[model samples]
Target chain A: MKKIKTANYDICFGIEGYAVLGQYLNEKKYSKIIILTDSNCNEHCLPHFLSNLPTHILFEIIEIEPGEEFKNLEIFTGILQTMTELEADRKSVMITVGGGVVSDLGGFVASVYMRGIDCINIPTTLLAMVDASVGGKTGVDLEGIKNCVGTFSMPRMVIVDTSYLETLNGRQIRAGYAEMLKHGLIYDAAYYDYLKDISNIDFEDLSLLIFHSVYIKNEIVSQDPEESGLRKILNFGHTVGHAIESYFLTQNNKNPLLHGEAVAVGMVIEAYISTQLSSFSKDDYEDIKKTIHNIYEKVQIQADDIEQILSWIKFDKKNYNGNIYSVLLSNKGKAEYDFLISKDLVIRGFKEYLK
Target chain B: MKKIKTANYDICFGIEGYAVLGQYLNEKKYSKIIILTDSNCNEHCLPHFLSNLPTHILFEIIEIEPGEEFKNLEIFTGILQTMTELEADRKSVMITVGGGVVSDLGGFVASVYMRGIDCINIPTTLLAMVDASVGGKTGVDLEGIKNCVGTFSMPRMVIVDTSYLETLNGRQIRAGYAEMLKHGLIYDAAYYDYLKDISNIDFEDLSLLIFHSVYIKNEIVSQDPEESGLRKILNFGHTVGHAIESYFLTQNNKNPLLHGEAVAVGMVIEAYISTQLSSFSKDDYEDIKKTIHNIYEKVQIQADDIEQILSWIKFDKKNYNGNIYSVLLSNKGKAEYDFLISKDLVIRGFKEYLK
Candidate 1:
């Protein structure tokens, strides 16, 4: 059992380690077992999952459609209703077994249902294994606002099994790898250089990357669980990233951006902003830009699109008192938050991206 | 300042003490201020409240029509939307006024909006002042289920000013007092005796009763903030009481029972169950019944109402599996939870209430 201890809980990796789920369930003595998953994972991964678990432990499976579209309150409310119908009490354990959407929505449901119940995260996607599953951040999107309503509540445990990654398509893997790159870019320059050779990495070595990403995030969150200070560094690309994601999600005729894909672009733009305003070296900024451009195709932000994105950013939960705040890299591995970036500077950053 | 400190936070009492809201705001330096109130409080109390605050300190007020009916997700969504439109951020402070509905709904909004903002509760009704405002239990009722969708997130502070009670009608006062009496019945025998001669108590001295009730609740919550053990005692009457409350609230023909009124009846029925099964002395049970009957006007639960209420109890968040569980009194000032009772005995308990 390969186990990593976080400040509050443990993240167990591999089949043998996560198999302790049965042992945990027995010890806790939950009244019932519930598994929340998306349709994709349910068909592709749940069977493999159930086989690995201890036999004779009856559990209910709740499946929703796979996509960011399902990460809304309407779907969330439906799930809560089903849990109520099943008579799921506080003693029941809800295990989320899908990607970011399942982990985010299921975690939010567990945090709020009956003033919160125990939740276990079984991330079936690389993106979730590295990012969403580890952090205590749980939420559902409200009215085109990304994570507008949420809470910081840790899961009982997070199971990181790389075998589930076999079910994912190529784009899904790249989408998840984007967040893994982010972990290195914002925290460890050496790791960032190592991640640049991701194309040459083998599946057997992927678990190490997942562990490293989760460790960085856990260390950040352990210092600031409520996100009052140091944790904002974790949102390195997310301020602009979330706005871009929302723009695509809410608008018609726009191609939807995967969370990590959006953040990849967001990091490039924010890196440019950092070069102009903060002490970030221009050489380092170009390195970040080149690396991101190599992996993610360019997302054109037209003048009209820029206006809408700025509007979305203005209403971002991070900004306060009508001032726009962004977490920008001071250098390749260090970041600073609460930086009051002016609209002109933000527009300039986007214009620079266009060039 | 009459400040009662709980495990996580403090409850400040009196006009002068709670008036420090201005100072607190100044020291904390919130970006903006928003007050959540009901129509009744808006008309009767907002002006007085605004006057008490520091001049030049502006705040936005959002008012909903007062009632338990508005304590649902739809209204909760609307409130979240309004906060987003107003661009309320993590640095903003939300002060909730009115009764249980306002406190519960507002606290929930604050808890989830941008993953939580600072919440200061200025409880306007007696029920909220004593029970709803103190505990971190923030939520909304879901699809006829009471507090099924909620979270245990404490407010930044709770301000108890009895002057708000002057606006409440007599029924509302008694509704709040029911919880106060419950505090005594479960933990303090002397206070229970003090609650018995309610009619003779001076209104000017109401503050003392309010303080005592809050103290008892805070002590219980401090020990078991999550309600897995010692905190279950607070649910002594609430198991049956909540079902009865939900039954009336969901049915069109049945007049909705105020929380404390439903609780008063729940105590009588539960007293009988305790005497029969949990070693509660017959003499104490009779004393409890007599005291409750004298204070609260009888709410007749017809034989027809039993089946539905029973169903409600079975589905309560507190119970698990096929068995119905409740916190039953062992004696006055003592109680036990996870008491598994059969349906036949529950029906007999209701019959005993009717007698």
Candidate 2:
């Protein structure tokens, strides 16, 4: 069992999953327990979760559709309404058990319901375990804008269990691997190199790698939780990546890219931009692109899509004083944010990615 | 000019109205300014506000209907959408000018829109100037539950100009006076005595009184911003007061009690409760009742309404671990919170109010 504590709360990984959770449940004084999950986790992992729990604990199950489509105000408001109708109060605890969608939505609901309530994250997917469960950023999308409305409210606990990873297929695994790869590329070169041969890595042996990724994220977040300065380093690829993700999700004919997949492509383009604008070595940029491309297939961004993506980027929360800001890697494992990237350079970066 | 500072921001009263605001506007760096107001303030106070501003500072005006009915999720969401449509970003500054409803709703919108934006409160009502502007408790009602969803985000500044009070009717002045009177009863005995002849006081001469009330509130809030412990004392009259306010507001046929009017009655009943359960003297209880009745008309709470009010109190955010807690005054100018008041005692207190 490994416990990494942040400034606010403790996050546990590689522990006996149900036992740790059962202990946590007994520790907190709650009137009722609510488990928020999606259809996927309810069927694939909930049974194992229930078997591991202390028996006779009173809890209610709230399951919703699985996907990014459910990450909106309507869904968030609906969950709040349900909790109210259920008479959930400050003493009520919500254990969100699913991927990024569930944790983000449920964490946000807990933050605003009667001001706030106790919430615990039992992340079921690799992406959620690595990213969503760490930072106190909780929010839902507004009018198709990703995370346009949210708050910075930390959960009481985050329990990461590797057993749930077994339920994910290759694509799901690859999607989560994208964040881990980016973590290494932006913060730890050696860790990035270690993940290069990820195909042959045993699933059981990746626990240490997951812990390293979470630790890197935690260190950055704890230093600057409000994203006023240092925390922007964590948004290395998210600027363009989020734009690509939202662009696809909003279009009827286009299939939305998974968060990690869009981020993977975003890193490639941002790396190219870094090499052009910053002291980032060309060799490092090429290496990052090659590693990410090897793990995740290239996502084709059409020439016409560039305009739409830039439009989305223009409104990014990170931008300030009417300037587009991007966090560029000056070297492997080192990033600096608040770089004013021009539209011409961004267009060139996208052109280079197309080539 | 008198300045009162809290943990997060500073509030100023008795300052040169437009000049102080003009200086505040000049001090902040904003791409554009947005003023959020209601119909009442737009018609009554905006002209004076505009006339006092430094010319060439561009701003947009967003107006909504006036009243407590506008304080809801639908209106909150609508304001957020409008800000997005207007491209109100992090650099945008929102100057909310109106009563408690405007400042509360606009402050909440500022807190949550694009995560948060800089907001300033230019309070037009006495109720707002004394209580709503200082606490940083910004929220809207949910399903008739008061402030069910909100956040504690402070504004950049709160500019309290008593000149706006000249536009208020007698009832508006009395409504806000209730909070000032409560502030005295709970935190300052001398201040309470000063307000005993509130009807004889002139609105133009009440600036120092407003300043004192705000100072008392600021002292208590700074000590306990989250209401985790000591801050609940500020809820002295609010427990029963809020229940009575909610009771009337939620009923269709009944005329709603202004926040202060309901709270005036709540203070009278709570004083009765205090006398029964604590060191409060019966003479003091009758004194509070007579003084309150002298200022505001009696609000009749039917016998049947006791059960409904109790139901509302059962879910107040301050309650924890399934116990309904009340902050009862032990004597004038001092309060103790987290007292577990039983239903039987609460009924007796209400029955005493009826008598």
In the range B215-249, model 2's lDDT, one tens digit per residue, is: 99988988888777898887888878888888888
TM-score of chain B of 2: 0.96
Q: TM-scores of all models?
A: 0.98, 0.95
TM-score top scorer: 1
> TM for chain B in all models?
0.97, 0.96
**lDDT digits (tens) for residues B1-355 of candidate 1:** 7989877777999877555778888888898888999999999988877878773445789999898888998898899989888778889999997799999999999999888998989899999999999988889998878898988888888888888888988999999989988898899988998888788778877898899999999999988887888898898888889989999999999899999999988898888899888999999888988888888898878888988898888667778776788889997888888888777877887887778
Regions more than 4 Å wrong, model 1: none
State each candidate's clash count: 0, 0
For model 2, the docking class works out as medium
Screening candidate 2 with a backbone cut-off below 3 angstroms (N, C-alpha, C), the clashing residue pairs are none
Q: Provide the overall lDDT of each model, using Cα atoms, as 2-decimal numbers.
A: 0.87, 0.84
Q: What is the TM-score (0 to 1) of candidate 2?
A: 0.95
